[model samples]
Target: MAAGGRGSGRPAKKKSPTKGTGGNKRRGLEGRGATPPAHLRHWHKDKARTERVEREERTGGKTSAARPQTRTRRSEDAPEYIGGRNPVLEALRAGVPAAAMYVALRIDNDDRVKEAVRLAAERGIALLEVGREKLDRLTEGGIHQGVALQIPAYEYAHPDDLVSIAQEAGEVPLIVALDSVTDPRNLGAIARSATAFGAHGLLVPSRRSAGVTGGAWKTSAGTLATLTVARASNLTSALREYREAGLFVVGLDGEGSVDLEKANLLDGPLVIVVGSEGKGLSRLVAESCDLVVRIPMHAAAESLNAGVAAGIALYEVARHRRR
Candidate 1:
């Protein structure tokens, strides 16, 4: 008879109704009787739906088709391109892999563009017809010459690779480096000489240096295709790496202690650093050299162009190494 007897326990509690039903079937909750406020429930669902739509948009949802494309909208995995007919042609001849090529539709069977298209076809590189505006944007103000090649950026060889390339050819390694060489023509000419002389390779800085462009390729007469040219983040760092790899660093300066021909370049591995035509090597680059050698000249010339200086120095090194 006690009130606490098991049989007398209070009747099972009725299931609680979910809150905020408000006589609306669509807004009803299961039987917890704890529904949120009506306004809050509507707001929560709307907010979640908005977030889901926003996420889809950010991820390039189906609705992205209506968005206008941007000029700078490059493909996510498109290879870097180097434009101009000569560069493209040279790249093709050199057996470089081109991911794709773009020809100006306006060109309409131009011989040069046609040749580029043929080359791309032969190499199995895809060819696309793009508007001139796209070509201009792709080249970034470069001389596209009605041809743009989507080849990967130049793959530079390590300075030490010079040694093996030379030794394997049964010759001493003769490498060239440029200090603040600004003229693409000079860079190209140096490449030409380096290739012609059977020198090992050439190295230049990644910044403040002229790249292998159309003008430079023409200057090289396509010799760049055969030569192994390496680019360094900086000349000093490249020189240091060269020195560490058992190569002597020789710098060219007009007012140096030793003559160019007298330098002992043939004794071992050598890398010659030639400065810019106007402003010779920077103070740091000059100090990094093991020795500063000068090319003897009469008072007739104030200085030599960087290309000429590099050619002269490389010739001497090659000649000495041969002897």
Candidate 2:
């Protein structure tokens, strides 16, 4: 009491256990070790890393740091080609349908360009003309031969007609519908995937749908030749007709009530509707479905690309159909 302050109730509170723990040599060195100083932490970290890498190498295991990563640009399903008289003529003669065609009006009308125009019109493709600069952008500075045609986006078949036709032939009809998929590439990729998976045909709206075009054909890598494509006046009406014909129509949505795997897809003919790249199935289309199904995914990803999602759905449907 005499040594301590008279008014203090007790000795001043000692520092916290952790405060001077670092300074206590006996406690710090108890395990035949000393705490690493701040400057040496990096050294210890690097040493441990080096040791782990060496051990992995000796054991024939790869370390995370040892693998190099790479990125690759996949070959597009449809790629634009630029060439002059002979090439364009060859493409047309080879049965490549040009979606849109352009001619240089200023040039003296030549028979080759005239024939190009004739072929395009015969095939019901649009023809237009622009300044050389615009043609340059379209042809990427390649020989345009004063004529270029945007290739047809996709091959189409009438959904109703396809179903009836398939039935008459004693084969189950498989049709895929798109809600609002606008990207020509996606449309082409989906077509390619559908054809590859043995789907009968593809259906899209007359409006807001990517039509058969060169870009899509390129994306399909000539798969369009094997597929029948159909354009619907109104998709809702078409879906109704499908249901009336005893076909099961399923819509793919992230919040679907039925898991795709458990859905009874093998029972009969079916139509799989995939939403647009940006917005999924429109309200009317979603409401028209006999069932709404979803592919289970982890919490991390909100959704998948429309083309990829369509491919997966088609694969699942094909798998069941084959069984």
Candidate 3:
């Protein structure tokens, strides 16, 4: 046999294990379960953050000094709530329905708290005196101010119902539509004006707009109970429909071509559309309006809040209708 061929396969070299290649750790099926990445953790802690967003978006839900501990559920079945002294008292005054009212044990015996208790008693709603910790859990760590109410989900109506409601009442319908008005307080103020001025119902876009939340309910001072605030899937289409239904569609803008004072459409079925504060009106919605009108204002005050402007417009409509 040849020397190289007989003994040789290059001295049969031995391979050494590489460092940091998971030499000692188990691999494949032998490995233990591992934690998911941060983004993949759907069960991460976000209850407080989520509650904060919802709290801020509420009509009167501005974050107050009283910070609450967050309690939340992923499901939509969880009941709605309003907390803090002013919120609870106003909600009670407005007669917002409540399955239960929770008062913290040894709460400050303040006037608003007293009024809330009295109102709850008068309405025959059960009162549950609970510990601060329990109250915090119930409100999901809101600034409860020793009081809270468990309320039903807000009920929304269809835009078409406004016209039908007016027809059934045998009266000229006056409707107010809000475009991108996201403040709950503004909604409440507008609702108050609508109730005051005999408006048939209110229309709000379903998206990018604030709904009749607890804050709005309390701000309305109970007028929301009698007023029908309808939801519109698309504002432009809703305005067009209002026009086709024999109701005049008027958009309110600071730079409108027509003055609201001399407007002649108040006598018939009408819808006064108010836009958002920052963005005024979207192009599509503005174009759909039959007349774009602006209220007269003196120099210095360039703009009014969406709510204040809506109240003024509603007053003018009511005044003209009465005349």
Query: Top model by lDDT, which number?
Result: 3
Q: Which candidate model has the greater lDDT, 2 or 3? A: 3
- What is the per-residue lDDT of model 1 for residues 1-323, given as tens digits with 9 covering 90 to 100? 66655588766456787787566775454466777886779888899887665444233233344655453233323345567776777767766666788888767575666677787898789888877877786666677877777654456786567778987998766788888888878988898888877777888787888766544655675677678887777778878877887788889998788998888754577788889886788899998899899889999999999988888877777677667
TM-score of each: 0.64, 0.57, 0.72
List the candidate 1 regions with Cα displacement exceeding 4 Å: 1-80, 108-112, 182-185, 205-225, 231-241, 297-300
TM-score, prediction 1: 0.64
- What does candidate 2's lDDT look like per residue over 8-70, in tens digits? 666765666555555588675668667888668998888888677444423334334545436
Model 3, which residues run further than 4 Å from truth?
Answer: 1-77, 84-90, 110-115, 122-124, 131-144
Model 2 regions lying over 4 Å from their true place: 1-95, 98-157
Model 3 pairs in collision: 59-184, 68-141, 68-142, 69-140, 69-141, 70-140, 71-140
The superposed Cα distance between candidate 3 and the true structure at residue 275, in angstroms, equals 0.7
For residue 123, model 3's alpha carbon misses the true position, in angstroms, by: 4.1
Per-candidate local distance difference test: 0.74, 0.73, 0.81
Clashing pairs in 1: 17-33, 18-33, 19-35
* The 10-residue segment with the lowest total lDDT in model 1: 69-78
Best by TM-score: 3
